[model samples]
Target: MTVDIEPSRAIPAHSWRRWVGLTGLLLAEAMNLLDATITTVAAPVIRADVHGSASSLQWIAATYTLPFAIALIPGGRLGDIHGRRRILLISLAGFLASSTVCAVAPSMAVLLPARAVQGVCAGLLIPQTIGLIKAMFDGAALGRALSLIGPVMGLTAVAGPVLGGVLTSADIAGLSWRVVFLANLPLGLAVLGSIRFLPEDRADRKPSIDVSGALIATAVAAALLVPAIDATIPPWARLALVAVGLIGAAGLAVHMRKTRARGRDPIVEPSLFRDRGFPAALLSSVLYFAVSTGLVFVVVLYVQEGLGASVLVASLTVLPFSLGLAVASLLAGQVLLARTGPKLMLVGVGLLGLGCAGGVVAANLAPAANLAPVPSLSPWLPVSLGLAGIGGGLVTVPFFTAALARVRPHETGSAAGLLNSVQQLGGTAGVAGLGAVYLHHTGTPGGALAIVFGTCLAIALVLAVSATAMLSSPKDVGQP
Candidate 1:
């Protein structure tokens, strides 16, 4: 006689429960994304408090991303092995504790370490959100569930700088920069309570940790990020670190194949790189993210330090860019994507390059007659930033959609985890690489800003050409 078996995990059947689950997930994500850029607006203030060197400022920005990029794959695997609901709660608790630590941190020594912990917690928290969405909903529900990420992302993008500026300026009980971190507590606590409404889900197959793969990935990221902080080091030392990072990467590739051949889980599927569009899409994303993230860091500093704008004014300068990004992202997904596909991304990137050029010209044209610290220029600043924001909006959806269009259903989880990892990794690279160049020219910030923007513009041009060649073949415009 055949026996019937019931699944161990419960799936949410009611629409309201699923929506509640989604709200919790989005809330968690908003916190993470908010933390990403929020701290950036307050970086100068934090540096002043800590009396840190330029390198330390880069560390403050880049350290969070270091562990975040490294821990992502393993974190997702753990969620599958244990339970998404369980892992998410634990992660949020850790995030809350870490935020408290950050708010009370007495020194850069304390704050930086706390920020690193926060990154790992964020790494853990993010994967569970995507996993829950995938597990809870299917068909139309899944589509709607996934669609929420875009707007939430855009909303957080707009909110991060403004929130940071407000919190820092508010000086809540003279907390100043600490408010940016403290701000997370209420949202995290609320989400922790709300998560109980979500269904508990776990993978059916037994999940195993890829310890070796994780270590190698961490080492590779460390080697890549560390040298970017201390640029005064000898050329040979930097090259040696680069060599070490490349070697570690090679080892990781070999290890993944061995793991796959042994029928064990790898951090990522080695074969996913074989797709024609996958590698280019991945490269473009890294480039796209590097320029996008590095631009924010550079612009914030330029406005504050170069132009001598107050923190609040500096924050306001970024507002137009963020708004443009939201509007463009909405249009890209709702309208332009159906008609233009990857070509739209090319246009966006090109516009971003143009925007960078415009910024350079505006900064160059700053009047010497203005005794105020802030530059007296025409409307170029807002217009240029708005152009960059729109460019970001145009590229975000198409790149993600195209990258995953050919991904197999079974590999979706791994693909998503790996892509997110790359995105974080790319952000780290932007801060470390570009921030180093910016710091090196601190005495001549105008020249430094010029060089940094020039580098981004060059990368954007290359992205446009390479992406065009790869995506040239006629495909369905509405495919994504």
Candidate 2:
């Protein structure tokens, strides 16, 4: 539920305390971003140290994102029912604790559970950041605060891998890959200390939790994800899981209908589906993120395992992509979005598709080339990644603006939350599906990379075409 903060509840516009509180919220967001990106850079080192199997490595990433995606909608409702400040503080503390467990975990068995816990805490805490910002500032101040989010996110995207590489390569106190998880401790504490500046606020009328609906949704996601990621599962079992996911989806539809009939809000608003454009936007989002995120996973693995690059080199190799994305995002948000709207997103998709095509060429050309230095890596690879990153930047900001352009005010909160959830879910599916494909061809790393890039290229083309639905959406009524 969206907590519409009454103007009276907002901290005074001129107050310094509100700015301090915004710092804390941004730090919390950085912590989440850091953990998510940092792990990929360290995953190979972690697997080697723990003697983990390929499936275990995939689980390390998947466990966190899947649970995080499932928890997001419920997490927002939690903030509305409980005070946002209270829930945010509780969840932040939980995230730190889970990170500690992850840092010290001796095996994938222990680490996977810890990662899942961390994801849940992250999901619970993240939604509150926006809600609290709304409570703390309004008008121009709100716009300024919201504007800071994109830059902070862009900077974090660039920094996370570099920091992870430094920590892993430094082998600080012999912690090695564990240092990536351990690094969150000091940062989280700083954020926790600053939380006192935030004002407490909750919904005037508490919303009821949809426990069954949450469970069914979780089950559906798990049913679909597990079969895709786990190679050990027998063919019959995999098919059964797919069937279960389909059934669960049908059941969720019926359950949501009943909940709305009872005059209670469901985990997802059924009414939002009435718009043809919304579902198309969702599918486009899922496909775009799946390709983008899955490619990152594949590239990191390819450079390290295929080319025998050091952890630091692998991280640096991915740097240009992040830099391209960062620069493009700023331009798109401040300038291009207002002028081109959905057409800008289509252009972004086309670039990403071209990037993927380039990746396939690069993989086939330099499959066995020495990649110890960032400069020595195939030129096509970095150029491809940079192009993909630019495309990602263009799509990221406008997708939300266009998707929610037509949403009703009351449905805005649910629509935004679901969008966030699916993006995470898309990442999870990409890692599972694309990671599985790569794993199957691990013996031929170059061929594997080519195949993954080809797959991403196909998905990107489909996403570009499908995303035209955004064009059909009416311009946002609230825009100037």
What TM-score would each prediction reach against the true structure? Answer: 0.93, 0.96
Superposed model 2: Cα runs more than 4 Å off: 369-376, 473-480
lDDT tens digits by residue: candidate 1, 334-376: 9999998767888888788888888777555554233265556
Residue-wise C-alpha lDDT for candidate 2, range 233-342, written one tens digit per residue: 99999999999999999999999999999999899999888777888888988898788777887788888887888888878878877888888999998899889866
Worst 10 residues of 1 by lDDT: 1-10
Which one wins on lDDT?
2
Candidate 1: segments with Cα more than 4 A from true spot: 1-12, 367-374, 469-480
Model 1 TM-score is 0.93
Root-mean-square deviation of every model: 3.6, 2.0
Quantify all predictions' global Cα lDDT against the true fold: 0.79, 0.86
